[model samples]
Target: MSKRPINQLSLFTPGLDTDPAVKATMREAARSCALSREQLCDRMNELAGQAGIRLNGGNAKQLTLATLEKWLNPLDREHIPSARAIGVFCRAVGSVEPLQTLVAPHGLYLIDEQQVRKLRMAEIEEEMEALKREKQRLKAGS
Candidate 1:
């Protein structure tokens, strides 16, 4: 007997197209972030409490170690938090490492405050230079 073809809608899920190498790197990063010396679970709990994030319909006090375990454990792919939750966690904890890890495989990086300031400064300098050139050109034309 022949099996029916799967629908296109079912063929594409978020992260389904991620490269294997990238996925492996992300997994390693997740493991590292979860097991860091700072204790990710405790940090998450503290951050969640501070930020008023309710997990699994539970109050801040209800956010348990097991919930964090499910989030951090790379093997528990089925229970990983959504991307938005990851971003919220990172911001609440004042650490972009987790977000950086998640996006590194996609050739992207989340710039820190210092990096952002530097980038903006460079952009402003470039704009100033362009304006200077334009001024010079107009003067020469006149």
Candidate 2:
């Protein structure tokens, strides 16, 4: 019932603050990227191959081409080729922005990326502590 793939969300999204112009810009960038979902997946697969990294199916969810490149070929910087290819693809498609750069500052910074995961884990710990306290209170009441 949707126009796009079932698993895919539209690449174009409104800006964080919900400005129409920003959303327009994002849509423009996604269009410029010039890659379909399948192509992006293959690009990632190719990079993984070059790094000689064997990715298990389960781990694939956690693995991204940029992340894998940063981890596996940190010193060599060979993975840059992949980024450049994507940039060129974007340019050819009339995309004015380096969509990667646009999105990275917002989505994939060292602090923000790590903080959200840490916060979720902290929440889990807090729930466990509350449960433990509740159990003690019940046992004392009896």
Candidate 2, pairs of clashing residues: none
lDDT (Cα, tens digit) per residue for candidate 2, span 1-142 = 8476443434564244322332344345544566654455465456556656544334553245454333223244332333434443344344535444435435432244588899899999999999999999999999
RMSD of 2: 15.4
lDDT of 2 at 100: 46
Q: Which stretches of candidate 1 lie over 4 Å from their true place?
A: 1-39, 57-61, 83-94, 103-108
Best by TM-score: 1
> In lDDT terms, which candidate is top?
1
- Deviating ranges (above 4 Å) for candidate 2: 1-112
lDDT of each: 0.58, 0.48
The stretch of ten residues in a row with the least summed lDDT in candidate 1 is 7-16
